[model samples]
Target: MLEPILVAARGRIIAGVLGGAAGVVVIVLLVLALTPRAGGGTVLVPDETPAPRWAPPADPPVAAVTPGPYGIAGLAEPAWVARTAKATGIPRRALAAYAGAAMTKASAMPACGLSWTTLAGIGRVESDHGRHGGSTIGADGTATPPIFGPALDGDGVARIPDSDQGAIDGDTKADRAVGPMQLIPQTWRNWHTDANADGREDPQNIDDAVMASANYLCRASTGLDTEAGWRRAITSYNDATTYIDAVARAAEGYRTAADR
Candidate 1:
């Protein structure tokens, strides 16, 4: 009987040990199910899209002004002149002269579409609005220190002998292009006008130069409104393909910048 009792006690101890082992296995499985896997676990991600980059607002279009005189007693400048000058990096006085010349031309010759930007283009190409070579445009529209082109003595340039006799170009031997617009003495004499209404036709004066340019451009067969007209007018100014291209590029730049 004692042997049987010992055997029964051994069986009960073995069963208790097996039950504890089974309980540990179940607890391990529960822990594994509650815990997250390395990369297979579900995560709460916010569904949102990123904002786009910002851009500056577009500028409003400038209104056109009625045609009028561009002299000292000329019409007042529209508010857009200042704004366009600031936008295009051009000086206010130069911009005003260009705009004033265009308006004056419009009044004098209504058929011509002489925009201020075109004049500005020519000014930039010619003498940088009279600021070329350390020179500046004075308050009276005169280029300070004066501006003169190389003497046209047939030395790889047009061979035009002195026409003014040292009166205008100050060169008694050969004629040199004078002023910011680079006008030959004869050409200045032919198309000269008192743009400033100061009773004198001065080539060094911005107003005089601008008015002369407008007159010459308008005299072209086409009126500067169409592409052909524009090209023809610009050619009339310099008569060179390179010059026309440069003026066109500058004018387009000014126009596009003003719109911005």
Candidate 2:
């Protein structure tokens, strides 16, 4: 699964993100950005246990994804972020990216059945919400110093020759996965986003990385509300049964924790 990309912020502020309320003022110029009966996911094949446990997360009323104070990151309900952050222990900043990305997708791909909790579940598994190795998610939603997976050299994982030529992964010898979503250079090229409206589609940016992950899964599977669909979509993201189940458990936990 992640062995290929299984590896996975913040930073210092990005150069373009002006200090203070200025960035909020700039967001007004930006634009907006699955599933099952099992709740929210994408793909094929039904689980032995279906529908109930994997049901789509509780439907929170999402604000319209319009120009906002923090680009798409502002779309999540402030109250929801506060309460859910306490319940799930997700950093408010990263939680916003997860929730806001789902809301942005809602208007664009309502049929996809994606949910913020599902995204959080992936975040927990991917990079502990970008907290791996003590990294932080900047206010602008970028991961500092960036994150990279172990080199894929066929030692125990798939061996992929250099693709980005040391650009994205910073490795000219092997193609290491980059970003919180752990997308390899080749995969990142296929599904990239600029949800933060920074004009750059950087995988290191959680806003971009999370949205890109949603794009990849939504495109991979028709829907993710059912066990079959969720499993399929996760499998596409990481072709391992263990990985699929891990995401399911983590996502389900977030959904349950938030609802409480």
As a whole number from 0 to 100, the lDDT of residue 73 in candidate 2 is 80
lDDT of 1: 0.59
* TM-score, predicted candidate 2 vs. hidden true structure: 0.77
Model 2 lDDT on a 0 to 1 scale:
0.65
Q: Please give, for residues 120-184, the per-residue lDDT of candidate 1 as tens digits.
A: 77777666777666578876788888877666676544466887898888899987667767676
The candidate maximizing lDDT is 2
TM-score of each: 0.71, 0.77
Off by over 4 Å in 1: 1-78
lDDT (tens digit, per residue) of candidate 2 on 1-260:
12232221101101122234323110000000011223222223234554333535655535643535556788877777888899888898898889888887787997777888778777776777776555678989888768777676667555677878899888999877677766677767666779888788998989998998887667666567666777666655654443555567667877788887
> Lowest-lDDT window of 10 residues in candidate 2?
25-34
Give the Cα lDDT of each candidate. Answer: 0.59, 0.65
Model 2 ranges with Cα > 4 A deviation: 1-55, 64-67
